[model samples]
Target: MERVNVVYVLLYDHSEERILMVKNKGMDSSYYTLPGGAVEIGETLEDAAIREVIEETGLSVELDGVLAVSEAFLEQRGHHAIFFTFRGKVVGGKINIMYPEEIEEVTWMNAEEALKYASLSTEGNELVNRNSTIPYVLRGKVIHKN
Candidate 1:
């Protein structure tokens, strides 16, 4: 079985009512996505999210907490992505392109606007609504493996 592990951060600015997101370097070109990526061996999920955010957005984050855990298999891509999503607060570093290889631009958008651009595998409405973690899944078979 092919397995992919990634960490995504949801950076919230309560004062601004916005979230920081990245325009990702997609398979074709790039698409806007929550700042995140694959976790390497020996790295904790929080560390992965922090590293990925810095790599893709040039920012350091203070994790607020774990937000969600998601897993999905893409039939077309023939891969499974197990994701750890965390709630984060921007702590330091300027907002810029940290890695030109995988990121194009960064933007801050409110929940509504973000919904328009993000191809969210999981619904963020609850994030907007209850401000809590919820189990989320996308298309394909879901297996609870130990």
Candidate 2:
């Protein structure tokens, strides 16, 4: 199966009760996902996460460490994706849609309220509830590499 690596950043507000997320029109017309994107060639996962957040949400953040990892078999997209989720703090920048062309909207949501969105990314939902440890690794099914 063709493989791809991506990163997901859980950019929490200083109070630690809110999350930075984006409504990515390109990925799904109806979902809000964490601020992150693919790891480009030569860029570390940490750097990619920071870059993606700034590009997508216009916020500069400092990563704490890996929070969780996940794998998804996107049959429709024909790729097996490995997602590295990082926990980070917003250090700078104001709320703005940096990539308005791609991002439908960006917002700061109460951690609990964000979880209620039916279209929120599954991996994101899972991680929100599993904050007991750092770098929690999630093993996904090979199913179809779908």
Candidate 3:
């Protein structure tokens, strides 16, 4: 059986040209991604997103809506874990990288810029790969499955 995981992408207007993203820590130095984590037992997906975002970025989000749901089988921490990607919006609190051990740096970038930071692995490609159904622009409502 494969492990299940849930992660969220925290997005803000950023003047309609860019969105905030965090560089993951200890993942080959180029593992930058949205702020999110795995869903704990007895916890809802939404709750996990909020908790993960806060833990990773020290920021509280209003969760504008579900951006996408991604399921990928990959080896992490010595096990194959399925990953779920959820996108949300920040509503309050200051932006700070609290989990330096897991998060190295935070940067805001547009669609092209975001993709540049994504990993070439299937996990990263799946995230950047979008279909017609998923809006190309980084605004409004959207959902994706992989």
Q: Which candidate leads the pack in lDDT?
A: 2
Location of the lowest summed lDDT over 10 successive residues in candidate 1: 133-142
lDDT of 3 by residue, 1-146 (tens): 45767656646455655667787766465577767777898776667878888887777886544445545556465445544454566778787878777787776778557655533245444543432123223344567988
What lDDT tens digits, residue by residue, belong to model 2 across residues 36-104? 888998777877988998998888898877776778898888889998878888889888887777888
The window of 10 residues in a row where model 3 has the poorest summed lDDT is 129-138
TM-score against native, each model = 0.79, 0.78, 0.69
Model 2 score (lDDT): 0.77
Clashing pairs in 1: 26-30
Work out candidate 2's RMSD over C-alphas: 7.1
Candidate 1 per-residue lDDT over residues 39-69, each given as its tens digit? 9987777778889999888888987666767
RMSD of each: 6.5, 7.1, 7.9
Off by over 4 Å in 3: 76-80, 116-146
Which candidate would rank higher by lDDT, 2 or 3? 2
Q: Candidates ranked by lDDT, best first?
A: 2, 1, 3
Which scores better on lDDT, 1 or 2?
Answer: 2
